[model samples]
Target chain A: MRYMEDTLLHHLHTNDTEALKTFLFTIEELPLLQVFTSLSANEKAIVFRLLPKDKALALFEALQPTAQHHLLRSFTDEGATEFFNDMAPDVRVRLLDELPASVTKKLLQSLTASERDATNLLLGYERETAGRLMTPEFITLKKEMTVEDALAKVRLQAREKETIYTLYVTDQRKKLHGVLSLKELLIAEGSQLIADIMSHEVIYVATDTDQEEAARLLNEIDVIALPVVDRESLIVGIVTADEGRHILEDEAIEDMF
Target chain B: MRYMEDTLLHHLHTNDTEALKTFLFTIEELPLLQVFTSLSANEKAIVFRLLPKDKALALFEALQPTAQHHLLRSFTDEGATEFFNDMAPDVRVRLLDELPASVTKKLLQSLTASERDATNLLLGYERETAGRLMTPEFITLKKEMTVEDALAKVRLQAREKETIYTLYVTDQRKKLHGVLSLKELLIAEGSQLIADIMSHEVIYVATDTDQEEAARLLNEIDVIALPVVDRESLIVGIVTADEGRHILEDEAIEDMF
Candidate 1:
């Protein structure tokens, strides 16, 4: 840890963004988090700012809400606003819930309309429900689409979606239909319709389901992500196993406190 | 658990092979393992024989060596030979080590030359070392290969490989040079060289490294698989996170006993 801190310090002093990016990105998340926690607020800000945008977003998302809030406090308003706007809606909501009401309001106002709406959509759910923790950023496939077309759509949305490992299939009306993994898609014939290949028995949760229950379902099924649907059975979002683990970790920490 | 057992019994009574496959495959592995454990030896054999070949292999791989041994004893010599031949080399080695010397030798005789050689290769390594716990099946990418070629190779080898989630970049002499995820390969331009996109800093273990330490490194890196190299730095095999977890679990169970 000390070696890492010293290496980072040297990278900082030398202004080596390439080496710094590689150094920071290559380190394991838990160890990196420890290093960040060990640094002063100013040092934390410097390190965070120096990270490439994607790496910064990834590191920021890995942080607990409390750590996120503390780090956000050290950033300039512009930096803070950009980070808030860029965060996945579910993660942004967690951070917003940690901030003072006025600060939350200001941050929410700074978001683009789409992001603000997405954030508000999540906020509408009960605090401990699956809906509140799921990211709305997911690629849904139509059962009629060929595997080739579905793969194209997945690749296009891969940058924005929370996960492409597990894909959900739906009708035009947004009714959940089937689920298939990326590996399945990769192995299937390109001309095959998604409905022909996808498993009809998709294991999923309703929006109102308890977060812990949803996490358990995710773990039980051993899939990358679990779909969350509304009362109408309209697919709304997906909760990743990572998010589920985080929710459990946060719950455990709260219990400890 | 009772409900699951009842469902399995119903499937078996009705002789519903298709329905049984769906039922067994859809259930979580942990719960399914529990159900298997609770069954009588005859019932277990019946249930095991009913599973689709692929699902049977998967379930067999998930069981601890003791459970695997118990299950194997109930299988006919022909069934046992086929199962032994199909299993990943590392897993086969573990189960083989548990059998009495004569039975192990007979089983070894039953294996195809390739699988027999692979098993022998792993057996040569010291117990509780990475070499003894890594599957020899892995896809390696050359640095000069285009992303398109790499993707094609990955798709071609996906089924046989232990994991397609992490791909290793290696030279002609099989020296591991870099590493990249499938996601990275998917997102990169088709014309780009693998060398340009892969991370030069690969996290790996020596073949002789302690199994527990190798598992720790795999966990620390958060990759699906860790490449294992020989003393001469030649890529030998890969140890997956699932295998690492199983090793840890078996160790814990051993400690308890």
Candidate 2:
């Protein structure tokens, strides 16, 4: 298991912060996550505090919710907000679901308006449904848009969207009509309309659709992303394959405990 | 849990093959899998027998291996050979790993030579590692190739390759150089060399690296496929995100049991 309590832990105890940072940086993220689990609560705190802010945030977000709760308990309100607010919407929702009601309420109040709204939308949907697991930051393009125009739109909007791997084409009313992969867009003639080349067979999930079924479809089809829609059949968010993986893993962890 | 015992089960009871096939056609694959789980032993055999050959193959491959074992017991050796030889490589390996040594031997003998070789390669590695989960059907391209050339290669090899989302470029001795997404290739000028456009941060797993760790890396990075390497850092096979999701789900099911 490579559970060797080597000089790296020794470096943390010896108060050699420089050596400790160097050593920790050399270890990959998953192994680092494991290493933190093995430390004394005090040792964990000491080592966690010594990490650079970016590394600490990345490592903290990767942790299971119970471990995250323990770490959050040690933080002041401002410290907690900074850490919690930076997490992906789905992960943030999961952490909030686990924390005390009062903490969740306060954390909700502390978030930026948009992040708070997205989390609320996900939470409002019934648990164990696609709505609860979707990320709200999805890009929607018009069905009539040219491939050239669509690619430009994606480039401009890509940073805010969770995934550009798969894009949806909706009518003016936001009803999803077709789906296109970024690969297809890149390969198409620039003058061709998205609707001409996009696959009209829209494999999607409704807001209240079962999450396990969604995960199964995502895995079975091997699509990098799938669109989630509300009752109006308007696109609301995306459930990336990566998030699908996390949902399955989290459920597995739940089974273990 | 839509556990309605409706007229479809009625059709099965009455031996109404036409009605049962018609009703089953209206159901989706995932729900069909769940329905199969609820059937009694004799009922399962009757319903499974009524399915068309293609539908039967898909349904059988999606089943849990233990359930598959039960079905195999009821089949003639010739019938079992037809069913066992058609599963995806990793799924086949997993089934082999679970069954009695004698059953595994018989199935391995019945497989095509190429499929047998691939199975042996994956089995040669320690279980619960990237090697065990990876499929050797990945498409490789050279760093010197133009974007046009690479895309052409992808189209020709797409049917056999596990994933076309991410492609790796290797040097003369098969030493890994960099990675480029198909999206990047599609958007780039067709004449550009792959080495010019690829990212140097090659996220990969060694052959004996832990499977859970590999799954985590694939999820965290949101990559559809990852390179699996031999001891000298040569790419041997690719592990797709689909496999990553299954590995996590299977582990979760194990924990629940």
Q: Largest lDDT belongs to which candidate?
A: 1
- The TM-score between candidate 2 and the true structure equals 0.46
B119-170, model 2: which lDDT tens digit per residue? 4432335568887677766667898899889877876676545567788898
Candidate 2: stretches off by over 4 Å: A1-133, A136-160, A183-197, A206-222, A247-257, B1-132, B139-160, B183-197, B208-222, B251-257
Which pairs clash in model 1?
Answer: none
Candidate 1 structure quality by residue, lDDT tens digits, B15-132? 5545665687688767888888887765665566545445565677787878776765554434334434555656544433222222233333344435544444323355678866
What fraction of the reference interface contacts is present in each model, in order?
0.24, 0.00
lDDT score for residue A118 of model 1: 44
**Position A150, candidate 1: lDDT:** 90
Best by TM-score: 1
Where is model 1 more than 4 Å wrong at Cα?
A: A1-122, A249-257, B1-122, B249-257
For each candidate in the order shown, give its overall lDDT on alpha carbons.
0.69, 0.65
